[model samples]
Target: MKTLTVFTPTYNRAYCLEKCYHSLVRQDNEDFIWLIIDDGSTDNTKELVNQWKQEKKIDIKYHWQENQGMHGAHNTAYKLIETELNVCIDSDDYMADGAVERILSYWKKYGNENVSGIAALDATIEHQIIGSKFPEKLNRATLFDLYNKYGVTGDKKLVYRTELTKLYPYPIFQDEKYVGLAYKYYMLDKQYEMLLMNEVLCHVEYLPDGSSLNMYNQYLKNPKGFSFYRKELMKLPFGGKVFKYKQAIHYVSSNLLMKNPKLFIETPKKALTVLAFPLGFLLYVFIIKKTRTEVN
Candidate 1:
């Protein structure tokens, strides 16, 4: 089996997906499989991928399913991955030069049962790091500490054990399509720490249509998904009261957006939920106003 499975979950992104494909073809190392999860594209994405498959320049696996949003596509990827390790490279993103070789080499040296996998850097198309690099002396840490305790910022690339990624399949809400992808990472944080690599693994471009760029709109459209994510975060064992309180604020707002009556009752931290009510209500009103203004 290949050492890594690099999966991309794509919707109607065929226009930009070719950039990701060419980058994979240029890899200095060919010891990885490219899995494309086609999330119900009305475009010519299937034909595009079929041409790439015929080239045989690299191994490719493709699966097409009805549009279930990003998190649902992730659910399918985790289920289908047969490799020991897996990393998600977004449709509009591509691996950095020599990234495949770097990852396999690093894991060969440091991987063991004690850890889950590696957390590496991500960069912009202009070759700038998205956030601060890992602390020079730091070796391993859970994804949570890399932000909360260490003062690290911005999005980082995560390579996780396929077995672990499969453990927390994201829940699918009937009409809602947005769920914070960090839900699974935080769950893994409870069980294992990951080896940190400062090397850039992927280059990301946040398109206008991408979820990261349109979060307020996502909040308005996917209240149940957001509410469920916030509630899960509040239950993490390692997160402190302050962290839980912050989650409560978002939780309250999401519930309000959905008009759920049991906000306080459903909250994992009831007192914090009560304390967070004022701000949460304000937040709900602000989101409503913000999206409304955009619409007009």
Candidate 2:
């Protein structure tokens, strides 16, 4: 069995898939498998992967399924991966020169059943750390501590034990009203503390087309989705205590003020003041405009 399974779920990202494929082929450690879940791409994704598969440079597995969104691809990846540890590398992202080697070495030296997973640094544009580092010795953080300390931003930074990861399939929702795959890690945090590795392992390219870059548009298009996100987040095992009502109020108010300004105008004055504080409203508008400009 492979020690690690590195998977990518792609939909219409054929242009950048080769970078991921080539990087995997050059991994210092060969005890890893690549699982590509093609989320119903009409592009040349299948042909691209198939050529690589035929070359047999690395252990590659490919699956084709109707596009169910990111969470759906995650659900499929979890079920299919048989390795002890799993990492999801976005199609647009690639691993650093010796990332898999370093990850394997760390796991062999420090990993055990008690350690739920390992965390690594992710480099965004210009190969810089996307954010601040989590403090060392966080091998036993509660769900709240993970978010408060690590900020719970990028999915690529985490490597999960396959057993624990498979336990939480994406939660079913009442409406297609939410953003992509925000709550799964929160669910995972309830079950385990992630081991922190201060080294940079993944290079994450923050394309203007990336989902996280379009928060304002997503909010405007799907307030119901944000509401559903809040509801589902509250359902996590440790949700209520970790993510209190204040967080929810802050998130909703900020999003509305940025995406749906008219809705902010309609909010009751007292609640609005509490949710959208003095600088919060200004920052929200500024960020939205800046991000939209970047996207354009």
For residues 70-93, write the lDDT of model 2, one tens digit per residue: 777888999999999999899999
* TM-score between model 2 and native: 0.78
TM-score of predicted model 1?
0.99
lDDT of 1 at 174: 95
Clash number for each model: 0, 2
Using lDDT as the measure, which candidate wins? Answer: 1
The C-alpha RMSD of each candidate to the native structure, in angstroms, is 0.7, 5.2
- lDDT, model 2, position 173: 41
Off by over 4 Å in 2: 136-143, 149-156, 172-180, 221-225, 235-243, 250-296
